[model samples]
Target: MRQSSLTGGAIMFTGYLLFFIIMRALGLLEVVELRAINFIFLIAGVYTAISLEKKHLGWGFTYFQGLGAGIEATVLGVMPFAVFIFVYLSWIDPEFMVYIREHEPLGHYITPFMAAFVIVIEGCASGFISAYTIMQYVKAHTAHPHE
Candidate 1:
């Protein structure tokens, strides 16, 4: 399970970094609406983790295991991604960071670390929800063979 999720999480982080970097290069990073697409990457990563872990566990796969895979993938993936964002903002693109401060609600209170923490919370929550929703469909397929 850990190995599967580590692979999936690495893929997820790469996807996220490339996407954001491309968006930044394209001068679209400021488009807050596009941030929603990040969830798609998140969903994909969680699904990959759960599926791989399920296969590895074979008849032992369970709902809890699936949930754990999802959570693990997101945490492992998002933590470094958050770190990258913090570095990008704090040094690589302070101007954009300033722009975020000006545009966001309670903008004055925002910091790079705060933003990264929010990503962790949001990514984990979204990952859990994705897992639950996915398990609702996948659980039937993953049931114990003897059951």
Candidate 2:
């Protein structure tokens, strides 16, 4: 992987993990309640990813560049999440379907695909905001001690 890719991935993953633990500790990880929080973390993760990417790549964050970076980070960051769901919900969670049927029943309403689709939608929203903000921040900051 490129330097920016590795850095962005590491930063995004670590940040997400930390936020996950904190939210879980605060009892806000109840899938239903934490949906929004997860979105926020997505943005934050993207923001951090872009920041690190810009620093490593030494590229200015033009609109297109930022958008591309955000999308890349979002896709990479969410890859693990998708795999996790597969493993946990399909292979590990003994009560995955039961819990889903009870808490997020959708056959009578929305389908399971819709529920999963929400994750991608939320990721897009968060990624856009995060990329914009992080790029702006990096653009504004100057005189780095290391540089």
Candidate 3:
């Protein structure tokens, strides 16, 4: 379970980092803010982690196991990105803050720390929801008649 969670988290982190870097390089970060596309990648990562856990456990994974794995992977995966965002906003590209303030709705007075806080909150919420939702399918498919 630990191995699966670590591996899944790493995969998730890598995917998110790559996506962010590519989008930023292409100057699409602002345009893609808070979009479904980001959630797609997040969901993919959590799903992959949960699937790996199932495979590793080979009929031993329960609803809670899957949910826990998903949560672990999500938190581990998103931490680095959160750090990156904090650093980026604090040092690397302060101008991006200005851009966000100008373009984002209700972003007129948002600080860098506030942005990072929002990211963490959103990431955790998404993680929990995604984990719970995915585990439902796993539970339905794997539940035994006798149990």
Give the clashing residue pairs of candidate 2, or none. none
lDDT (Cα, tens digit) per residue for candidate 2, span 1-147: 344544555565566667666765786545666555566556665665655566655644344564566667777776666555445445655364455666664633533344446555666567766777766765666344456
Candidate 2, position 105, lDDT: 49
> Could you tell me how far off, in angstroms, the CA of residue 51 lies in candidate 3 after the best superposition?
1.4
Could you give the candidate ranking by TM-score, starting with the highest?
A: 1, 3, 2
Q: Candidate 3 — which residues are off by over 4 angstroms?
A: 143-147
RMSD of each: 1.3, 4.9, 2.1
Clashes of each: 0, 0, 0
Considering summed lDDT, which 10 consecutive residues are worst modelled in model 1?
138-147
Q: Could you give candidate 3's per-residue lDDT for residues 67-143 as a string of tens digits?
A: 88899888877777788888888899999989988988899878888887887888879988999999988888885
Which residue runs of candidate 2 sit more than 4 Å off their true CA positions? Answer: 14-31, 57-61, 105-117, 133-147
Angstrom error at residue 86, model 3: 0.8
Best by lDDT: 1
Instruction: Compute the lDDT of residue 95 as modeled in candidate 2.
Output: 61
TM-score of each: 0.94, 0.64, 0.87
Ranking by lDDT: 1, 3, 2
C-alpha positional error of residue 54 in candidate 1 after TM-score superposition, expressed in Å: 0.8
Candidate 2: C-alpha RMSD after superposition: 4.9
Clashes of 2: 0
